[model samples]
Target chain A: MRRRLKSAVVAVPVAFVLASGCQKAAPPPPLASVVVASCAAIPAAPGDPAWDAVPEYVAVLIAQDLVEPRLLRLSTPEIRVRAVSDGSRMAFRLAWTDDTRDDLPGPAEFVDACAVQMPRVIEATVPAPQMGETGRPVDIVFWNAAWQATVDGRGDSIRDIHPYAAVDHYPFEAASLQPGSAPQQEMATRYAPARAVGNTMAGPRQSPVQDLSAEGPGTLSPVPDGHSTGAGRRTEAGWSVVIVRDLPQALTSQGDSQVAFAVWEGGHEEVGARKMRTAWIPLKLEVKP
Target chain B: MALAYNWQIGRSMSYWYPENRPKRQFAAVFDINKCIACQTCTLACKTTWTSGKGQEYMLWNNVESKPFGCYPLAWDLNLLQQLGAQQWRGKEYAGRTIFEAAEAGERVLGWRPADLDYAYPNVGEDDCTGRVDRGAALRAPHLNWFFYLARICNHCTYPACLASCPRGSIYKRPEDGIVLVDQSRCRGYRECVKACPYKKVFYNALTGTSEKCIACFPKIEQGLQPQCFVNCIGKIRLAGWLSPPERARADNPLDYLVHIRKVALPLLPQLGLEPNVYYIPPVHAPDEFLSQLFGPGVPAAICTYRKGPDDPDLAGLLGLFGSTDRVVPRWRREDDWVAALDEDGSQIVRVPLKEPVYIREAFDAQHQVTRTNCP
Candidate 1:
């Protein structure tokens, strides 16, 4: 009887071990790659479109500065990063070129003519993905070092201000044009009168040039008080505008004269003029008589 | 041991300009007449200096037409309108300028990101009417008149970019007077971009450094012209060195600059960025218009009186004024106009100007007309 009992204990322990072993372990899940979309598709970088919504977000840290975005040309072996869209997540790789911004000494500041690169990462988010689904891709971004910190208010120091503030802010009185006029007429009425009063030059037309280059030796004639006294001088070089006239609507449409008074008067020398002064406006005009 | 290595790196790092130091002296003289509207200067600059990821739009050097164009979207107009016209002198930029900023409390780095975006939009592109349609079809006359305006960093005697750099990343090279942004030291704050009235400084997203035109000193040192000057189809560009003191000279450079404007010659000087790029009045425009464009001094300067039926000055006019801006640099109105390197009181040393070999055409054009008469 004692021998039989010991054998039964051993058999019972063995059976318990076997039973536990028969239970199956969960199958290992599949590995997946992360994908990201472009900013156009998602407006924000992947992982969290609103991830940067918080002020503490790294992007906000960079974007807050009030500086114009510029390119940093570097000439070293760089990794090229092309931006690709995968919804909000975009994909990119670092690109390298031979350009560098390092300055070399000489009469002029010489810069190397090769492209450079910066490092960035790609991250994405999956709203309704199963446990191990592949997420969207993120677009590639590059680093620019020219960013300066932003200031909350207009700087107190004089140096931090623009020099031409006054002219830029010069007040403009909107012309209350006559009701239902043609687009051209409405524009002329709104701008022409104010311009005429501002230039302080006599005549219905504004001369294109101040001094007339004479084609022949003629005695200088004083213009009558209300009348402008110059004609188109045919210099061997070219024709110079001697008198400026603001022609009536009738003459301007005919295109008989070089001075298009009504048309020129339509635009004000306000903000547009300031922009004109700073930026390059490429305009080529030739008069065929 | 690590500290020692760091110290060694720091010691090796030296710079040409430092804060609170005396500013260096440098100047550039653009030959207004030589420029052609090919935009080779802009391309040369973009390819050589500003081509990078962030600087997709940045143009350290740009050519703009007068009377109707500007970069950074009318930078001067914004400020001018803010401050009504009033009495002012040099450096007395009243009211709000692009560089002006206010501190928010005691924050050491008054960092405000949103304000930066609006203050200076670099390389601000706008639609331009480059070629005006005076008429259309065979009967319609089209005037091909686009002015070439080559631009670069002004490196002002008193650089606004330097003054406004809160971290002091921007500096002017004392040796050659080139203003540069130190990318390594720069935290990408972009203060220089905001502060520069000319908006020459740009934020390069790739390097996070503000990039600008480097004056091509390497090529200059090698005794070669900058890419723009060398590649210019129209010999409109001249590269040379101008002494710094010229800015302080009692005879303002404008006297010479405006010389072209005074005789029905227009300079488009109202923006107040004090651009180094100047224009020699276009030949085809009328004198009264030119006078308006340039102001009132051209007629007197050119001796434009008619001598009977045969105009004497006509020949001189034709010779002096061509269909383009390729005028002799010396004849330009800058106070520092130097006839040659050896000339006394010359501000800038003249370098070799590689005139394009339109030798036959130029000679024929010059000879065809009387030396002083418009043919």
Candidate 2:
């Protein structure tokens, strides 16, 4: 509703021609690929000096052509990413501008999170960008701030987010007087398999990088040997997150693969399917000397 | 979501996932004829489950006087009335289920009850319709009739609450087939609250999440019955697991009562959720009223129940009501009786071959002499 046209706008391309005559600044290039430089040793953490070999890429908004478009959180347009590999392991550092630090998710709250996705099979006919196609699956290493807090030794207990929550009867706790005696509530401080029927509530697992394999939408399931991991920190203007994990099961040998990234802005109530992401980017591994 | 045949309702309804039988399901049956309208069961459930801060108005187990009562005001009276006008062909209820009514943005047969609807927990208690003159005698055929209808979540084989939740926070546990809310994942959208036609799911403002009856899973895990079933003073409630029609055994208490004897039927089977809670419709209630409430099965259920001593299965079925605190998983016919057995083959209860005759017989000389009145 608030706008100032500065001056009468000229019609069509003439406006751009005149604006170019003044020459303010050049627009950034479209995001295409993230170059993962093979390093002597992959950085175990984001701030490590060894990550400099990887070149930064401007991650533009994954918009216009979205398989499942969630008309929310389009504010954060471009993100900075750097990737590095050391033959056996891969890691990526992502930094995006976000004003608010949303680490704690309450009853109606959401938390900031990000994920890295790669085709389960190294190189095959392109799979659906939305997760993947059946038989042709995708490997995902997901990260969350809440889970990072847990990995940092400060348990992501419900009380940690909801300070006012007082629980007197948590029968599922390992420290309870009668633990393992009956079905129990999900305590913030502990993790217990949900007693919810069928496949409905199977999604509340709290591990940061619970490596998941998906073969299309709504078909995400946990995988064995999902040892993927990550850590996240909040900067003044945004968050700097680094995710590290060995190549997924299918990519055991050196070959060309595909990688994708998705970012969730918690301040905008973005969770689940309502986030931003890329379709797929080419990822190549160099041959051994 | 896809359309699948719900054999219990003998129709199709939208389901979010494929159907697979639980190894064991938590189920219950309530005999409305024997309910004394006591609040004991309600109190027992309240003290056990929904007595938390935001649960001031929550009654996970409520026994309301029907035809004139509902806790969330009318609950589903509007929906029932809407569904009532729908056509039924033979045993089929030809109408749109909540899933078919998807254009309206709800997956099941439901409507959002206004907040004011929940303001009063007891809206119509012991209310009757007709007003008679002071001198007029109370006629044999009363015009107004109401019955105590106790309710809890059905933990349905196909749950609308489970399908309605966009977040998929509601789930039915395969371990015991007890439907529950995962508080951690619930964003408090109230989709489950709106979609449960029974209006059993409640929204907790303090926790900013929805809550419902957990079926007393702790006690169930310990091989005990729920507090509501254990504390019923009228001895009219039976808690057990039901089997698919093909698998139901003649001796299992629930199987005999529901499938073999055909005396108990699921409430509103025409809605097609394949509800787990079954009810023995009040025998004296008008056929039209009972039929509408229990679906086309009423006449058969009542007829089977009234077959009396002639029907070999009647006594064993009738005797199982309120017989034990734990559900009998299986049964064995022992001569003239039925021994209800658990998973370990332990007898949980025994049903006699004949119904007990509590009336004083006119042929008895002691009764005739004591009364001093004979035909």
Candidate 3:
């Protein structure tokens, strides 16, 4: 059934437009569709050869200045998106330009990040792009540069962040308690309360991408037992990140979906709702016969 | 947005949420005139909480000398400059609050301090205003003056930090009104750190979460004062429950001092957070600066505070400060003894209204030696 839908998607015509004008040119018309090409296996990295075969959709980014705590300035002007699916899973490769690499979290510092948002349930009408409206929920896969750094061998320990920090001792590291013992784990949890409480943002990172679901603004929450996987690399001029998640079952039958993108430039102090974002873009899933 | 009544501003101001007051509000009164800047409270808080890896720079309780001193350097001056011309019409504030002054698409008018800002927690420590001339004589209201402003989380009635958090991770405890950040829910956004005018909310880099003075809720739950309050060397702090002005009781120490006696005032009341921590304005500081810091209540509060022995009720209530480690919900002055009481009207502690003075003879005839330091 999935293979049948793959061939059906290829039959759909691709609409591509090029703008040519004087010094002052009209803004390019919004990209008609983001084509999700089918492949034997979804790429796990942006540099993978399979992504090269996929069409790139350049989405214009606008500052999120529509609500309270909004971004007043635009930082990431545009993002290039490429996506592919391998029968059971879907992956997106996002690349954007950022001058500085901000991966360290500090008192006032924010980390560079990007997110791919899709409606939790596909319906006749697309959900609102602003994190979806009430009742209409969206699933978001958020990747952070700092988390990527942690996963890429940079230590998540305090000593790694503050090399000169001196400490007499931590009760959790006491000699009496055996390493990895229940008592030691309990003591460790006492000090790292956020980690003990299962805050995904705290503690060590297994993957850079976090799965979240939101009903509307201020409702973003981590999805339990999320299986998303991603990797991000810092290129000379910017960052390229690949995020993978299980393919939505509805796409196999409908062959159509919608996705939105948001980017945060840590150097520009962008985080939370203060980010550059795009409205919902049409997504077509290609099937292979 | 909802209109919440801020007693400090003496008006209903713009707030993100409706006025949902707690069952009981945690409050404290700091007698600024008595603070000697010993930093015992600072150390006490440090030793109790915030002693972890990423909390090296965190000071849940800090003492900064006013006029020239600031933790996170100029946490107040920066916001004050932005708020612009804080005006007062008697007890009513005529100026825009941080909420009202919020820019387009912003929750509160606030600024986040840079990482280096926390580097100089003791910047301008002990620095005084106006140079003392060569022949400057001792006088009431001295020319050069500075006071130690010991600060903790205000646990505000309308916390700007709580209002600005997009995740709703920060909340005011409906039981005691202690504002806190839910560690599990926080995504290290630091929106609270940027929105708090007092800069009490701190971002812990390692944990990737914001931490603040829990108001020592552990102790509060046990019916004891916070570590800072119990360890204060100056005996200038009194922790208690505060009732709203309309429901204020004369016997309630916080209400008596803040509402009835009006001897203690909230810091930067014009910002409109309705900060719970109250200060007895420094009696010697100039009115201009004091008024700006404590709102229009400065002169009156200082006046009432200076009426020292004459105002027995106020004097006795002050004597109750640091009299016990237990939280004082009710108090009374009977004859020469002032007593601190619990919620059920049982005495927690008591102290004499006046310290018994003793006069020692210069000649120690009994010991056959002269007492050099005695009068």
lDDT winner:
3
lDDT of each residue in A169-225, candidate 3, tens digit only:
776777898999998878777777687788988876789999999988888999989
Candidate 1, residues B297-366, lDDT tens digits: the string is 4345344322211432222222222212221223222222222221244423332122235333334464
Write down the worst ten-residue block by lDDT for model 1 chain A: A258-267
Lowest summed lDDT across 10 adjacent residues in model 2 chain B is found at B134-143
What digit string (tens of lDDT, one per residue) describes model 3 on residues B1-375? Answer: 899999988999999999999999999999999999999999999877876767878999999998878999899999999888767999899999999999987999999999889989898787764544555343334358889999999999999999999989999999999999999999888889989999999998888899999999999999999999999989999999999999999999999999999999998999999999999999998899898889888888888888987978888889988889999999999999899988889989889999899998888989998888647
- All models, DockQ values? 0.01, 0.04, 0.53
lDDT of each: 0.33, 0.70, 0.89
Give iRMSD, candidate 2.
Answer: 8.0
Q: DockQ: which is higher, 2 or 3?
A: 3
TM-score of each prediction: 0.37, 0.60, 0.91
Provide interface RMSD per model, one decimal: 23.1, 8.0, 1.4
Deviating ranges (above 4 Å) for candidate 3: A1-31, A166-171, A174-182, B129-142, B357-375
